[model samples]
Target: MGALELLPPDTAAVLREAAARTAGVTGLVVNIAVGYGGRREIADAVKQLLRAEADKGKSIEEIIESLDVDQIADHLYTKGQPDPDLVIRTSGEQRIGGFLLWQSIHSEFYFCEAYWPDFRRVDFLRALRAYSERNRRYGT
Candidate 1:
């Protein structure tokens, strides 16, 4: 969530806050998960894995063959946090928009016609209710 493919317009302040927040902070954690492309995130994970293995003196073939889901997940920024249970895509858009691509592989998606500003508590409750009704396989 901290790492990004691109930053939104004028995000210096948010970045500063993110830097200051430590594990001891008890307030709401606001992560700016932006400018991220799903494919790019996967590639970045692979790159990190390669670098780590190389640093430990792994051969190229060994690194490639040893790659696994856990290694890539550790490299991902959202590794420690639980993957989202539901994604609310507002403003009438039904697309996934590439948000949390790898992390949200099994999340329930809720598309709303209202914009973020207009998305109220009722909308959120509705999303939760709908998710409760579905039988998720959790990727089996």
Candidate 2:
């Protein structure tokens, strides 16, 4: 009866419901892509884009013109969610490993040495505090 065992069904239900409920929003979204693969996400996005275009009777050229990074992002599961203010990776992982690769373009990142299982509220607060103190220049 651990977290994993208690997760799948509720997670699936919530995600399905979110997708259904937000079918018309077509704006910001927040996808909690736990256990998600970056490459697979991109592939799925492309496939979905193709299907949507086919459904709309749009030509490939027209679709391509509309399928820039912003459009692709809009089509993502987490379309409307604000890009993260800060992405904190615990346990000192140096590599991003493709988590939120597109959304985090301008995000501030913090790496910590505490393992996730051992993470504490204070650790999170520290990360937030650090983020709050930084002068974020979005590629100025």
Candidate 3:
């Protein structure tokens, strides 16, 4: 499991410990967001990117010239992971509400009327089926 660094130090420590304990386990990586906000995450990523480039002795103009979507993505919390292909919004909410803003640029969405606690395996299957039926153009 992975989480944003914005959590309290004690909570962050617990998350780290959990990660260390699970490092050897294979498959089924679950990423949980704690005290996470997509806008804040993007802002934090940009801050880290600027700090890294500055430490590398790159001038502002040089950094600006070299910056790209991938560079920004590399600094994001979910770096090195593939973007989510399908996002199922529960609680009858049709909107994503700022979830995975940068990473979900091309994601497919499925809004369900049931609340998350009421969601079941059958609902998940339906979501998967819906995803399979789409001709995923990935923004063209």
Q: What is the TM-score of candidate 2?
A: 0.74
Q: Best TM-score goes to which candidate?
A: 3
Compute the lDDT for candidate 2. 0.75
Q: Write the per-residue lDDT of candidate 2 for residues 59-127, one digit (tens) a residue.
A: 998888777777677666556678887887877898777877777889899888898769899998899
Candidate no. 1 TM-score:
0.76
Model 1 residue runs over 4 Å out of place are: 1-32
Q: Give me the overall lDDT of model 3.
A: 0.85
Better TM-score candidate (1, 2)? 1
List per-candidate RMSD values in Å. 3.6, 5.8, 3.8
lDDT of 3 by residue, 1-140 (tens): 34536667787788789989998988554555666789988998999999999999999999999999888999998897889888888888888888889988898999988887699999988998999999999999
Using all chains and alpha carbons, the TM-scores for the candidates as numbered come to: 0.76, 0.74, 0.79
| Clash count in backbone of candidate 2 | 7
Superior by lDDT: candidate 2 or candidate 3: 3
Which structure among the candidates has the greatest lDDT?
Answer: 3
